[model samples]
Target: MSIDAFAATSLPVRVGVQIAPQHALYPKIREAVQEVEDLGVDVLFNWDHFFPLHGEPDGLHFEAWSLLAAWAEQTSRIELGPLVNCNTYRNPNLQADIARTIDHISGGRLIFGTGSGWFQRDYDEYGYEFGTAGQRLDALARDLPIIRDRWTKLNPAPVRDIPILIGGGGEKKTLRIVAEHASIWHSFSNTETLERKLGILAGHADAVGRDVREIEISTGVELDFSEGLLEAQHALGVRLFTVGLSGPDYDMAPVRRLLAWRDAANA
Candidate 1:
């Protein structure tokens, strides 16, 4: 196993596990955080969705930021944040303040992962207009800088400069935003898609006069990365790997294996 995995970098490659808060009781949701932190996971992420994404779509669910605040106070050693906050749900300035407060609550370990949201139900239910993907991405592009500038200007300020994580892999618009703004860019494509998207992002970085390497590449690990896949992604500068699990007695056998992969890669 790579000894340090995500934590191998000077800035730490960082492994993230997202706990889906839908379809689970509060206690189960509560214990999931304790479990991952105990397992030495680097980051604990929660999605900013109101309802279940899968497995009985209309099942019981909880709010996103409230859960995050609970997680922030509950854990002491792990970094915690939304895998990507839905920019449509909250105003950018308000989102910045919420993140800033959580940053202090977590004692300087919050990563502000955000994206142009896609879920129509969330927008309709919350009275946020469900716009086109291009429209939403455009709004996200606008909000990201506003949020960052607000972070710098917020009273008492964030404990540290919160790392900006721009989620989504839209080659034309989203990747350009990643090159311009994100400290971490989370994508859910297979190795092939990632390669193509990274090429596009590199072009965006060049156009923006930014180093592509400054932004970390992250992908989900529902299955192991093949040697060829790993080598290819690594060659393209992809480092951080994430595995997502949902609540109420969910198994973590996969996470243990991924953790070992991380250790081996860094060994």
Candidate 2:
């Protein structure tokens, strides 16, 4: 669950950008963030990791939520959050408290993106336990409800009811948690995998007495397959598609094309 960035829907089209916090200098990433929002992307995302996930392992990086606290204040229109934060990094109550603060920082434009812990490097390097996937997701399952409960009880409350975005495509556990807790569910699977997973997700939704449509389906665009994939996912009831690009030099050419397709598709 090392999502620091995600794409979101806005009006006739939805788009997003992620400025990899660990991979870039803060000022440059900050500038890129401002640029991304200026490009009219709906949501701005960042990942939660102590070290760089790609490129050099020992490259420079920054903490996830703190930068989000800054992002909350830095931009005015774009909704922002960690693409997906690791649930194991912070206690549920503390995470809720932090989210509440960032919620205010963005004047209620924050999306609380979270997921069951993954990325063993982040855990081990940070001195947190690298437990079994099931155990961590179980902690995540327990934690999400508590965070929501605490949100209801907190003073001043969240700036608004911050929307929750949960990532992962697991069957027995992860999707079940999404059915129970997520407002937006991000997936790495392409159309075929997404098509199959949708049924499983629906079963979980039905078991929990929840409507499948209540949780938004989200997928990614990697340039070559983006146009067709976005359309296919949209046909499968996914309106939110994210195109991820990371760098020393952030280029947004493909994002422009996807937005064009989205408008055409919805038209």
Candidate 3:
């Protein structure tokens, strides 16, 4: 499907911030979350990882779901989740239950972002098999249904049907899974890359008897929106864009830029 075939541009633009859970104390991370919410960010995300992705390797980093649980209580309005939770770390049923609990805690504000595990060091140190990429993708494919099924069986179910956000742009298995399962699809792509993948995703959606436009398109953004990258992507059906902030000092400037852009675009 061509970019013109999709209706993503008609959707409301949303801004998200990923508070990198590295190189900062827990209080600082929590403070940043509060500050971003106060600044009117639409969504808040933290990565699912055992260690910092950048800066000092052994830096102070906290766990993902635990922090999400904390944030569920800490904020009353903003939606929160892992930017992309690694499917390998916990059982599918457990993930579903945890997500359900957090959804209730947040009064139905969980986004449930997940992806195939990638960090080999995290897998090795955590004693999980650091399998081939295909194998991991296969595992994610198999587990997503189990997670969804588990949600149905839980007592006092999730406050709402949580939106599943799958991140990754692999043309084969990942896009297929996104077509079948994801309510939101996130990718780190420029205009060229995203346009191509939307075509692929449209094909997958066709195969699955789903409308490609039904899935919300998301991407990562930079501090500088002056280049018109965000607008270009928005033109191609991208609705949600996220900016990543790292700590010690989680600067709010980029977040402010994103929010300003979102407001202007929406207006």
* Top-TM-score structure, candidate number: 3
Q: In what order do the candidates fall by TM-score, top score first?
A: 3, 2, 1
Better of 1 and 2 by TM-score: 2
Off by over 4 Å in 2: 1-13
User: What local distance difference test score does each model get?
Assistant: 0.81, 0.81, 0.91
Give the range of the ten consecutive residues with the poorest summed lDDT in model 3.
Answer: 1-10
lDDT of 2 by residue, 180-238 (tens): 99988888887789877888888888888886656677776675654666766776767
Per-residue alpha-carbon lDDT of candidate 1 for residues 1-267, written as tens digits (9 for 90 to 100): 121222233443456788888889989988888999999898899899988898888898998888889999999999888988999888889999999999988999898989998888888888898979999999999998899899888889888989988888888899899989988888888767876777788788888988765777777767444556655565556677778887556678877877776777667
Candidate 3 residue-wise lDDT, 140-175, digit = tens: 999999999999999998999999999999999999
True-structure RMSD for candidate 1: 4.0
What are the models' TM-scores?
0.92, 0.93, 0.98
lDDT of 1: 0.81
Candidate that scores best on lDDT: 3
Candidate 2 has a TM-score of 0.93
lDDT measured at residue 144 in model 3 versus the true structure, 0 to 100: 97
Model 1: number of backbone collisions: 11
lDDT of 1 at 131: 77
